[model samples]
Target: MASQTDDTDRITVRLAGREHRDWTTYRIDSHLITPADAWQVTLGIPADALPDTVKPWAAVDVCLGQDVVLTGRIDRIEREVAKGTNALAISGRDGAAVMVDCSAPIFTRRKATLTEVVDLAVRPLGVSQVRVEATGAKEKVEIEPGMTAWDALAQACEANGCWAWFEPDGTLVVGGPDYTAAPVATLVMRQSGQGNNVLSLAVTEDVSGRYSEVTVLGQAHGTETTDGQHNIKHQETDADVPGYRPLILVAGDCDGAAEAKRRAQKTLMDSRLEGFTITARVRGHRVSESGKPWTPGQRIQVVSEPHGLDATYFLMARTFLGGRDKGSITELTLKEDGVWLPELAKISGGKGKGKAASAGKVVELS
Candidate 1:
């Protein structure tokens, strides 16, 4: 009893050097971000239906139509037997798991750019494919001891104000969220059996962590002869919010006032972006505007009067579920427009290796 869309949707399972076709698939949850980009498949089978050839650690490939949505290895399998019925569950992670699990040691003489650091970190792992965005400018950076490739990648991304994730085809993509595109669809809550196609929606707004003023204190270097002291310069920035909610940051590596100001401004922008979020559950698989499946980093228009919210947001995370009863549902978590940090320099401060406490400033140098 498969619907037209269901007939078109397919999942291909490969195990023990063999392909299992026409297997019943229950649910699929996948994302474009690390750790969250995983999938699960459930099949109705009789007791002892699983053959010995089907084992964990087997390679898996999931497809929607002709497009390969996930390329990974099977992590685990669960079997249930009850009420004269039985079922088998299989789950696995995307290719990024290799990067997340591999251990790597990277070093640079004096300094290197964010792009260079990232290239060095991943070169050791030998990922087959990548789509790294152009990250202009070099910055002084350090990789802490005993850091995994995943940790190093995260640090590089945070410093460059960009994000990285694995594509369904196992290509690692590093870039910033883009908002110039128009929204894919507009969601409006309506009465039962009305015009609304949404299943569930929730909006959140928090001002507790917001700050109206941000101050970044940087390194104090050689001072003027008049005072015969170290030169110390600080920078302050303002947020758009009302009242005075102040945040202070210390940049041990910050070279001067200009660098300090950049850090303060970036911090304020990050805090403001994280101040609010929207979570929604929608029916169907494709967006009305694009006629394509929902994907992370896409723009969408959301309207809900009860929550007093009417705004456009960027999809930060999503989970797609499809099965016999509910058909298909897409759960989404969105962030406001200003939250993307494409070209901005990031702030990093902490104890690092080699250099004296002072050599490594409180703020990272760009």
Candidate 2:
């Protein structure tokens, strides 16, 4: 029940983080200011009048002698409350209101802990791990196990006596820290091979858009030789032409080729493509009396080209038993051309006796 006045008087209030600070006579009166109005006045004080540790949006404890009175965050200056009067609102911890007269009381501001600030700002968005860091403030925080980085940060902020605000767009507004301190995105990739020499790759995205995090999950291409005598070469092509898109690749053997193909196709369809492609390759050998048949290792490659295009190609070798000598290579390429026919024809023409490759439209994979 503090009032407004023109004469300087000492007043105190409890801040959000349970820290207490003293204010000297700058102005005091019998008029009650809304929470919003109190915030405005607090911001109007001269920078030199407040402590050096005081910062914008800080949760300060106000007091009248030894007794704490109110708690709220410091907002900007309130310009036009009334004639010859300067006022600002303080948003209380429990959503209450406490107004202050800027011209009378000499107020003191103090710093709050980092934990306090994060607790007020962070909210769960279905993410698994969350990490929060302060850009400038110093504090040690212990994050609980199995908690997302966001939640851990909130707990830390609360413990440190800081104020955190959640923006309508989902970004966090923290006291004494910048937005860059928040974690952006996390990416997870899992790969497994089946009996049919087919490999499966799974990528998961777990983060909100407010963090401005971009993730690209794709396969890495490399050649490995076993026993030094077997030479395996595999090719991967995309049916669609060039464009910018994120791609993921999987290669290995599977029990059911159809099921593996279905899963891969579904992943491609479900993924958001800015222009990307995925390719897989499979190789196996057939032994004969003339010589040991060559079995090439499976390969999957995802390539992101310069012009914002993504392409993927898969190659599978067909083996012939009993010296029938029918070994052929099949190539499937996904390209991003306006017309698919030209690229398909080019891939088909590249076939040879040592290798037989085929190219088809993206629709074929669908």
Candidate 3:
């Protein structure tokens, strides 16, 4: 039988049973329970404070008057759905009957084992690496004897550079890219001058993964340069170049210098100058030079409204040239709109001159 003595305390009969013995204890609370019928129970203990001896699925007995009721293992402690008060749900073992929504608060379960904790923590990081904390009171346990899944998960993240956090709605957040970490491969492109004459160069390294292709995008212009002997050098020209557009470079093999020209050709054709008048000097020779008696590679300069830069001319010559030679490809961009004219302009004629012209010439895109 249950009875109340004062406003803050009450006496209730509690029965705990096992296979061999049964015992009863008197339960008391700080506040008097009204009608002694329905009231909430709370164990004001931190999750970590509980002992490790408690099993995940252990049961305790509860007996009230002539009616005998049983409560099973504690799954978790949650706030009351309606009143927002702390409450617990005792789950029964296999084939065992248990009561739901009990009024009195019962005992709290122990913390999870060390093994359980570690397992939960390592699950999300994948099997790449493992790092354990060296200093901390919690770190003392090589393996937590009894820890919850959540606790293990948190620890694993701290060790493996991975972490989980809750969103505003209590949703879990996980994996993100590490931008500071260097990429496995890089594709570098360089341009020496401005407008249509801007030289475009490309190189690739450390690319182990399967990527179909790479691209470089920028404006091109037409210009001329003369050597000490007064030889004229022609450059790429474009009438209408957009502020920004993507250029795509595709090739069969990413290895060796032969692929550099292929990639460069793709860049010229895919750039904003696709439909603009342009001339390309690929692999140290002009496009119009190819197939000519004096020219080793083709050096075809065209003024067609939207002629895509010729890729075959550049790629084939570059393959034959071989190595990391600097004289691979040079493109020029036009500053003003006009008909094509040939003049011996110096290579170092821009505002920034020698240094600035070399800045973006060989930028690695990947």
Tell me the deviation in Å of residue 155 in model 3: 1.8
Backbone Cα, N, C clashes tallied per candidate: 9, 96, 51
Clash pairs for candidate 1: 221-231, 251-362, 251-363, 252-361, 252-362, 252-363, 253-361, 253-362, 253-363
C-alpha lDDT score of every prediction, in listed order: 0.63, 0.28, 0.25
Better of 2 and 3 by TM-score: 2
Q: How accurate is candidate 3 locally (lDDT)?
A: 0.25
For TM-score, candidate 1 versus 2, the one ahead is 1
Tens-place lDDT per residue, model 3, 183-225, is: 1211122232222432333222121221223342222222376
Please report the TM-score between candidate 3 and the true structure: 0.14
lDDT of 2 by residue, 1-366 (tens): 233332212344333434322222221111111112131123233323434334445655543344322334454323335565443333222112111111111122222345442332222222112234334445444443344334444444433334333321223434322211111111112232122232222222222111111122223234374222222222222343334443433433221333244334433432312233333222212122222222111112233221221222322221211111322222222222211212112222111111011212233342
Q: What is candidate 3's CA lDDT for residue 149? A: 36
Instruction: Sort all candidates by lDDT, best to worst.
Output: 1, 2, 3
Residue 181 CA error for candidate 1 (Å)? Answer: 1.7
Error of 3 at 261 (Å): 40
Candidate 2 error regions (>4 Å): 1-9, 13-50, 77-366
